[model samples]
Target: MVDLSQYLPILLFLGVALVLSSAFVFLPMIAARFTGAHKPTAEKLTEYECGFPAFEDSRSQFDVRFYLVAILFIIFDLEAAFLYPWAVSVFKLGWLAWGSMMVFIAELALGLVYAWKKGALEWE
Candidate 1:
């Protein structure tokens, strides 16, 4: 049986990481409080421009198609990312890995086809 004490090093490492990360996040805020400027002016508060007055709010609604396309790009990008590593190590991997990858590719292809059929790929 494995001893609970065997995880002491990992626990210590996690504790140290937590402390360091907390310091990294909070130290900057503390330093800013001590040294940063707190002055506010109408010019600084206004939206920046190339000498053009603002016509609309910065927070604007986007079409659903924009998010759909973005998600599709991310999905395909991740697929290629995983494919490259697997392709490099293909010779060492067994038939099971090849079969699994084939299934993954097939599922992605089906999703792409579905998206295409639904006009999700079309830009208005």
Candidate 2:
């Protein structure tokens, strides 16, 4: 049988991490209950610093264009992230990796063009 003693340090480290993390999370909440001011007033409870009273519901409809642009930004951003690691390893990985990355980039470019044609990128 493989000696389980080799894993003892890892198990101890995990146990320490769990105890410390739980303390960090719950200690603050326990302290806050004893230390925080227990007061509620009408003005204090209302939303602050808006000069006029809120006219519309806070959860209001947003432009679909905003979400489209956000999603495009995230997609392209993740593509760059993936490219960085591949770029660093490219010398060792050679032509196959390079060709694969080129295909990935071409696909992203096509998506960008499609979004442009669909007017998903237009602000106005």
Poorest 10 consecutive residues by lDDT, candidate 2: 32-41
The lDDT, on a scale of 0 to 1, for candidate 1 is 0.92
Report per-prediction Cα RMSD to one decimal: 4.3, 5.0
What Cα-based lDDT does every candidate model obtain?
A: 0.92, 0.93
Q: Which residue pairs overlap in candidate 2's backbone?
A: none
User: Given candidate 2, what's the lDDT at residue 105?
Assistant: 98
lDDT of 1 by residue, 18-58 (tens): 99999999998788677865456798777676577667875
The CA lDDT at 46 in model 2 is 85
Candidate 1 clashing pairs, residues 3+ apart or interchain: none
TM-score of every model? 0.68, 0.65
Backbone clashes per model, in order?
Answer: 0, 0
